[model samples]
Target: MELYFLGTNAGVPTLQRNVTSIALRLLEERRSIWMFDCGEGTQHQVLRSPIRLGKLEKIFITHLHGDHLFGLPGLLSSRGYQGGTSPLTVYGPPGLKAYLDISLAVSQSRIPYKIEIVEHTGGTVFEDEGFKVEAALLEHRIDSYGYRVTEKDSPGSLNTELLKSYGLKPGPIYGKLKKGEDVITDEGVRICAADVVREPKRGRIVTILGDTRPCSGALELSLHADLIVHEATFAHDLAEMAHQYHHSTARQAAELAQEADAGQLLLTHFSSRYSSFEELIPLLEEAELIFPETLLAEEFSAYPIYRRQNGQLGK
Candidate 1:
């Protein structure tokens, strides 16, 4: 799986950064891409990338903030124009339905596909055969939420050598064995799948938080995550301002990652005040003092999720 940062800036768009938007590329697992928080000009950002607008199957909004969801109408309209006939599901907190309705009405946008809006109340918002998505209410000015996305465990691979040793030729029987079925061989010997297959590979966990201050919900959502994407709307020195605005500082985001024991922490939603992103290094270093896998987020950057040798998740 790969995470593509379409927009990483906080609040408003800047010359160097756009608003908050992220694309979770699941082409390896699924044929579609899942988008999180379509900020202003999000479709424009997608146009610049290799992302296909027709392939956007799911959208998860964190909050009603303009920076987080202003691009909904435009994206939906463009999806229709791009011949997206498949139904698309969007999940968010309450009031999202009204927001999209008003925007579509005002802009006179027509959608050719079925759009399903699911306004949840902080729990398991979505689940399918491939993945499960849970949400937790966050401490933001508005009713915000953070999302935890857990991919389902994949089936174990069949041991070809073991199968050959058992005189089982490779064919449809191999497929059945991989599916964990007991089959009787030509020699009248019963072969159990468990004895010839390895353990199932663990799925990757990715947690993405909306704009919020340091809170218990954030920590809970990020616990043991392979990748934690949290908003850092301010620097460490602006802790008071961050608290007042219900936004997190870079150092605070790092601390939460360390507390949650996340494998990697990605800091985004940067304020436009800082012209140079290099200023966040010291703040990230402060967090690395506790968790060494802290990283600063950049616009249009892609982070790959790697599986470790021990069947655990890495970076």
Candidate 2:
């Protein structure tokens, strides 16, 4: 799993950052990509990256803000023009269906693929064999939501050496053994999967928040996550402005990461006032003091997720 930031700015696009959009790359696991918050120019942003528009299987919107979902109509139309045949599912708060309906009707755009929309009310919004996605309401101007993505654990590797020690040769039988099936050989010897396989490996977890102020929902969604992506639309000194605008400051984002015990915190959704991202470093350090692994999200930046080695889960 990996996260590729297409746009990181809040409100509007700037010379340095665009609007809010993120791509969760799951090509290795599911041969598809999931996107969150398709702000303006998101389709254009994806054109510059390696991500394929046809591979976008799921889109989760945080709110109805123009900065968060203004690009959906264009993206959906573009997907049809690009020959996307797979079904797409979109999840968001109420009025999402009306929003899409109005956009498509006004533009006279007809998509060839099936598009399913799920209007959520802050709970477990989606679940499949590989993963589950939950949502919680956040303190924002509108009914905004934060998402928690939990990937299901994968089966462990088969102990080939252990199998060989039991006088079993490597063959299709090994495949059955790895799948936790007990097979009897021609010699009347039964082999159980657990006898030759290690324990299952734990899956990775990632939580991403939309525009909001400091709230318990953010912390609850991000609990013990491998990566927590939160909005930081302002600096710490602009706490009042952040609250007024229903946005979070860099320090507040850091504090949420620390409180949630997240493995890493990535701050994004920067305002257009500052041209230089260096100004947020000191504020990020305040978060780093509590949660050492803190980073400021950058446009087009990719964060790869690797399997944790043994004895590294809690840390």
Candidate 3:
């Protein structure tokens, strides 16, 4: 899986960065992409990246903030106009359905596909065969949330060589064995799948947080995550202001990552005051001091989530 940062700026757009938007590309896992937040001008950001509107299967809105959801309706409309015929589901806090309904109704927009809006308060928001998504209430001005996407463990590769020793040739029987089924050979010998199959491969975990102050909810959602995307709307020097605004400072975000024991931290939703690259370096430095694995998110940057040799997740 890969994370594509569509926009990394906070609240408003700048020449260097746009608002808060992130695309979790799952082409290899699900043949679709899941968006974290769709900020203003997000569709334009997608156009610039390799992400396709049609591939967006789900959108999880953290809050009703305009910077996080203003582009949602426009993106949904554009999805239908493009080649997105598949059904789309959106998960968010309460009042999201009303917001989308009114926005679409007022605009008289026509969508070719069905859209399912799930208003979640907390707990598991979505779960399927391959993945499960959980939401936790975060500390923000409004009722905000953080999401943890967990990929389920998968069966390891079939040991064909070991199976061959038991006189099992390449056939449908191998398929059954790969599915963890005990099959009786043509000679009446029973073969257990566990005897030949390797251990299951561990899945990856990704945590994405919305605008919030450093709180326990963030830690709970990000516990042992392979990659964490946290908002750092201010520098270390502005901790007091950040707390007042219900935002997190770079140092606070980094401390959260360290406390959560996450593999890597990607600090995003930067304040526009630090628009220039030079100005943002101090924020990065402050974070790196606390967590060396921290990275300052840049617009349009894609980060890869890799699995370690022992089946654990890393950056």
Candidate 4:
């Protein structure tokens, strides 16, 4: 899986950064992409990346903030024009459906594909055979949310040599073994997956958080996450302002990631005041001091999430 940062600015757009939008691409796993926070110009941003609008399957919104939701109507309409035929589902807070309904109705945009909206209220928002997505309320000015995505563990591949040694030919029985099932061939030979299959492969976990102050929800959501996309809207010196505005500073974000034992931290949602890389380096330095794996998120940058080789999957 790869995470593409389309926008990283907070509140509003700047010359260097857009607002907050991220695309979690799972083309290798499922040939689809899940979007998080469709900020203004997000469609345009996707056009610049390798992401295909047609492959976008779902969208998750953190809150109703304009910087996050303003691009939804335009993106939905454009997806239709771009020939996206599959049904699209959007998950967000309570007012999301109404907001989309009114916007589309007023605009009279006719989308040929079906669109489903789910009003999320924390905990297990979505789960499928391959993955589970959970949400938790966060401490923001409004009812913000943090999402944790966990990929289900997969059964290992069959050992062709071992199966052949057991005089088993490749066929539908191999399919059953791949699913971790014990299979008895028509020849009356029994096969156990545990004896002939490689060990199970561990899954990966990622957590993406919206605007919020340091809180228990954030910590819980980030626990053992392979990569956490969090908002660090201020420098360490501006902790006072960060508290007043219910936003986290770079130091606070790092502290939470450290305490949560997150594998890696990618800090985004930068305040406009820090306009250039030079200005942002100090903030990144502060975060790295607390958590060495910290990284400053940049627009259009992609981070690959991979399964751990050993030990727990987090720091």
Assess every candidate by TM-score: 0.95, 0.94, 0.95, 0.94
Q: Write the per-residue lDDT of candidate 4 for residues 13-114, one digit (tens) a residue.
A: 988889999999999888999999999988888888887889999999999999999999999999988889999999999999999999999999999899
Q: Which ten residues in a row have the lowest lDDT in candidate 1?
A: 306-315
| Alpha-carbon runs more than 4 Å astray in model 4 | 183-190, 312-315
What value does the lDDT take at residue 251 in candidate 4? 92
Inter-residue clash pairs, candidate 4: none
Q: lDDT for each of the candidates?
A: 0.88, 0.88, 0.92, 0.91
Cα RMSD of all models vs. native, in order, equals: 1.7, 2.0, 1.8, 2.0
- Error (Å) of candidate 2 at residue 252 is 1.5
Ranking by lDDT: 3, 4, 2, 1
Best by lDDT: 3
The list of candidate 1 runs beyond 4 A from truth reads 308-315
Candidate 1 residue 135 Cα shift, in angstroms, is 0.5
lDDT of each residue in 52-165, candidate 3, tens digit only: 989899999999999999999999999998899999999999999999999999999999999999999999999999999999999999999999999999998888888879
The TM-score between candidate 3 and the true structure equals 0.95
Global lDDT of model 3: 0.92
lDDT of 2 by residue, 78-188 (tens): 998887989999999999999999999999998999999999989999999999999999999999999999989988899888877778888899889888999888789
